[model samples]
Target: HLERLRALAREVGLEAPLYTCTAWGGAAVPAEGFLPMHAAYPFTPWEPDPSFEPVPSREFLFRSPQQPAADWWQAGAFRYPIERYPYAYCELGAGIQMTYLHRPLVPPECTQALAVVALGSGCNWLGYYMYHGGSNPPGRRGFLNEFTVPRLSYDFQAPLGEYGQLHASYHRLRLIHLFLAEFGDRLAPLPVVLPPGASTLKPQVTNVLRYAARAHQDQGFLFLSVYQDHAETADLEGIALEVLLPQERLRLPHEGSLRLLRGMSAILPVGLELGDGLRLRYATAQPLTVLHARERRCVVFFAPDGLQPEFALARQGCRALTVQGGSSAEEGETLYAWPLPGLGTRLEATGLSGRGVELLVLSQEQALRCWKVRLAGTEYLLLTESEGAAWVDAGEERLTVCWQGEAQLDLLSYPRLPSSLPATGLLEDRGTAGVFWRYRLQCPPWKARWSLEQPEPQVVRLRLAAEALEGVRDLFLRVDCVADVGQAFLDGHLVADYFGSDLPWIIGLKRFAQPGRELELILRFTPLQANAPVLRYFTRERLPLPASDGTLPVTVRAVQLVPEYGIELPWQE
Candidate 1:
């Protein structure tokens, strides 16, 4: 089959630089010069085996196989020599989707931690499966999804949702991507050096720290993973790691011991080059990304929830300068700095050559709002926490900022200031009470009322008077339900479908429903089995299902008409 595919590609006038095959799933032999690829899904909760190993294909690093079909390692069974091809991972599961048997929720922090661990484990290429979610179209045979999969919705709770909504994971993973984008070339050929007893450490052992480094020429990144898969982890205290550099062996923190919070991971710098004139001795806080300007280069770093933001600098004739937003203390030749709590702060210093090096320290919450964008052939970093819609046009040199529900924008870092501001008046905040239109269901014909709850899986016909949707431009029906699946219909045609998760189901009604006329609406629900064995095994404490009498307990939460507001900002090069 591999020969036939290669032949077909040649016949079709297609040439490829690299040939690869999936090395997992009962491995088969691949053609010579073809690289074998495997997926790393450490956070998957429904795996049959959860043990950690040390092999490159199964564990994390590449090792040459002794013989073909060897039972000693999982990848050895494929009869492929590890030295013949480069080891890479093409599919790392970023997050999991809902299934009939298992519904696993991947936290934002866990996603970031697993990515760091994969890199530390000697993974060369980092790729993600289903970074964004999508909806499934109707199938001719049946629903087209797996028997255990959701009927319509395929929102996998990934970094990007099915509706292009940005989750917290998006921002968290962006930090890692930005770092890789800047420093990946220097880290590509480095070899992984694991600390002793890392491979033999059991999942239950929380005292032993897991640390690894990818070093070339004595300068490398120290990867630390305090998170364990599917196990409760304790906080690691009094943590100190010894890193060997070209000139000397340095102990991190340079003062007191540090703590590693449970279920958190970080990649710290060792002998990192800050610029031509200075180098970073060591740092406890993780390096986020680097920002380059015309005059100077800035390195951004952040501390975890519990750890202190402390780092040392080693340079010739480098003196510490007073920073406006943070405190600094000088000890001997090394200078240490710390940022203010809750507020994002910038610390600056001047080297002997008069070159500037700035460090921007931010809390985790403040970092989530940071976005990197390109406008008018220039890059800009924006910090805004607006719930309303916002966009930027590079050609027009304009920024449309939205104001909704106490939304604010702080220009943390930008290339230059805007030339003009919007002349529009401020939009009044009417609160949730003013935006949400609530209704209840009555008996018989399902007439809408002002009170009482309605049963699920039943069609409730609703008529919207013109006054009810007076100034509404875009209307949405929010369904608060605890069901397996839901389908919303209008006038007899299915309009939208939703899969049950922690997020509520929102159906857009702007294009379908007429505002002034009476429209018929139908909602269909599918209840989950109350006695599923997998549900009992997985979620023994919380089932996430509401009590019901053979029918799903779904209710109409609200009819929200999101108001659109925009403010223009004039910009120049």
Candidate 2:
């Protein structure tokens, strides 16, 4: 079978390396005859430590690699080629799919910090298990999900919801992705460098800051993080730190100390080569993405609040240098500093043979919304604000935005976006800063209205007239209820399921809506059990589902159906 597949790939002129993902417990699964690029997906179910501080525990997990540093199993179980393959992960868990017994609610900060830590810990290629989640297919006997999970909702708590709704984790991971897309070429070769006590540090250590560096030829990035979800952590004020790289040691800021606030994270560049004459000594901010104009590259950086961002530059054959929207301090190496709220601030350097790169600074709030999208034949860094993007289909000229309650669309694009560019929705001109054009997206109102019906004791139904939804693009059905287990069915066919952890369900009704037919949805919700033992689960499964226990409650508070808007930016227009 492998030979046939290889031959077919060769016939099609595909030359990509072939690899297989397997588990450690499986036998003959790694397949000795296959190539040595075999790897396994690693998952860490984070739990609150009763003995140690949460900050240090979170830091340790991020600093450690997915694979074992030295594994005897690699020598016995399979012939793994460690040197040939870069330290990578089959799945590095951007977010976890929740189970009924163990429901761990993950926050955006967890993933954002995890991504930076993963990259700094020597993971070159980061692959998430379920980047986009969906419904599990129906099996021969029952639903395809395991006994521990829900029958229908595989998205449980993934980064992207089952109906393509983008969550907070999605945007956080997108920030890391945008950075990797911009600096991955240079970051791929640098080896991770840790501090002297990094390996020996325990989970109780909160006095020190968590940091790591990756350097090559004295040029790389320093990864810093201060966020953790498991435990409550306070802000660190006036924290003195030193980055002990393999070659040399240097004190941070090169001026005063820094205050590492709670939930703060960044990636600072070190001696990074820009063009031929420009070299970045260091920066206190995080690198987001780069935008290219006709002649120059606008290198972007995100300066978190509370700390002033400074950039140190190395001069090579330069007679003069200048900066705009920022101030320069003449020192051993010329350092340029930008104040707080440095939103869309532009800086230019004319020295070093005129080969200097431009810098675009963004505040931490704006940086979260910073995303890369191909618009009108060019890629631009678009700030989505609190309003986010679900998917951008450049080929179909569609941009889908998902909102739960009230949909507020705010977008900012670099290089001045025109008003007439969007195919759908109104782009209100909110003005511009520097070369950026700010626009607020406005779409048509909802057309469809719904009525509720209580058919059975624990079951309810929603009816939407097909006539009202005739021209509607998409309708998102948000169910706000106090039920434990929720299930949504269309035409008596089960399509969605949810446990108690899903506070309000965001189900996309457009997919199941038939053409010229009235939309009918059947829903069933059960009361949450206070203490359902796992040992008695099998015996309880055979019995009928209890509607309520009087002590526990179940109520369908409200059901809302909102129309989703999609706008398209042309690729060739």
Candidate 3:
């Protein structure tokens, strides 16, 4: 069968540079001249017992000869040496989908911690199975998903929601992605070095610190994982770590011990080269990304929630350097900072070899709004927390940015300015209090109306009727309710499902609706258990009843019909 598939690819005009075969289910012989791949998940089915340890399965890490082979492969070709091929993980489960028997809720911090552990464990390539949640389509035989799978919705509670809503995990994972995009090429060939007690630590051990590093060419990244799966961890106090670099052995903090809080993971730099003149000695803060400005290059790093921003710098042949907005002291050849504040921490170092470097330290919340976008072949870094539209400079012309709400420009940052501006002048030197450019713009209104009626004790029937939807491109039925589980049906067909949590419920209605047809939507809701131990453990609040009939209330908030908009730029040739 593998040979036939390879032959079919040749029969067609398909020529792939790399060939890969799935080696996840059981140990199988790799196809000739093909890359072998495996899948990994950090969490399993949630057990009711509080002592349950969530860790990756043994099949994900090791290959065994005594193990049973999968039914698809022959028995003799099942087991082989794993070190012959490059180690890579293609389908690392980012988040788990809830089945009928098991419904496990994964916190956003756990997902980020797992990704850091995978990269630190010498994984050459890291990939996710479902980065975005999606809705399952109808099948000809039956429903597309498996029997235990949810009937309508396939939302895995991923970083991006089913309706393209951004979650907090999206911004947290973006920080990791941006770092990889800048430094991954240099880190690909490095070898993993585990700490002293990392191999002996079990999933239940919370006292022992887990750490790993990658070393190559006198530089390394110390990866620390302070989180354990399905287990509550205590805060580590007065922690001091030692990292062995190529040229020297560096100790972190440089003065006193630092603390590692629960559910926190960071990648600290060791002997990192910042351009030609400056070199980082040691830092507890995690590097986010690098920004290339007109005159200087900005390196942004984030300090964790309760941790202080302490770092050291060593200058080699730089003429003049200054530290502003943060407490600093120098000892011999190294510069140190005790506790850098959340905002306005900059390191301006000048006069040696190339462009000057500015180290910008920000809090985790402030770093979430920083987005890197490319417009007109130029990259722009925007720092705004607004959920509306904004006007930004794209070289000589201005471009408008809009998402899902009212159009407004809250902040603008660019290397150059446009010729014309709005009536509101661009404010400057406001010292981080009010430096945003505000604007108000108009957008199309919602064109559809919907209402819900409870016909049965466990059923909710929603009727949606809309007119002038010809110009509307994307239509959505958004439900804002507080329920346990919801199953949505359109015109007697099971279309989507949703799990009610803190997030909003949304379903795409364009595929099931016509221009003039009345859409009949049915929703079945499930009530939460009053005595469930797991619910109280996570939510901390007791479940309340909406009514005495044990029926969950469902509400249809908005039926939005979104239209397409384009920005016309002035042509320059």
Give the alpha carbon lDDT tens digit for every residue of 1-573 in model 1.
876787798899888997777876547746575678866665443444323221212332212222222432343444566666555767777776766555656777767876787787666677777688777766777676655666666767778766555566777788788778878876777777776655455555656677788887667888887776666678999987888767677777777788888877778887677774676777777776776766787777777667777767774546555455667787777777666633336666777668878776666655566555555444555555455433233436665443222223233334343223312222222222111111111111212221222344344444454434333333445555556667766767566676565566754444455645655566776765566433333333334445565433444444433332334555555
Clashes of 2: 0
Query: Worst ten-residue run, lDDT, model 3?
Result: 59-68
Q: Per-residue CA lDDT of candidate 2, range 194-266, in tens? A: 7666765444555567787887767889887776555556788886557554666666677688888877666
Which residue pairs in candidate 3 collide?
A: 153-497
Q: What's model 2's TM-score?
A: 0.82
Candidate 2: worst-modelled 10 consecutive residues by lDDT = 47-56
lDDT tens readout by residue for model 3, 77-160: 434465566667777777777654355676777777767777777666777766898877777887778666676677777777
Q: What lDDT does the true structure give each of the candidates?
A: 0.60, 0.64, 0.62
User: Which of candidates 1 and 2 is the stronger one according to TM-score?
Assistant: 2
- In candidate 3, stretches whose alpha carbon ends up further than 4 angstroms from where it belongs are 1-4, 12-14, 46-84, 338-343, 375-378, 387-409, 412-452, 455-457, 461-485, 499-504, 509-520, 526-573
Compared with the true structure, the alpha-carbon lDDT of candidate 2 equals 0.64
- Candidate 3 backbone clash number: 1
Candidate 1 structure, TM-score to reference: 0.78
Instruction: State model 3's lDDT.
Output: 0.62
State the displacement of the C-alpha of residue 352, model 2, in Å, after optimal TM-score superposition. 2.5
Best by lDDT: 2
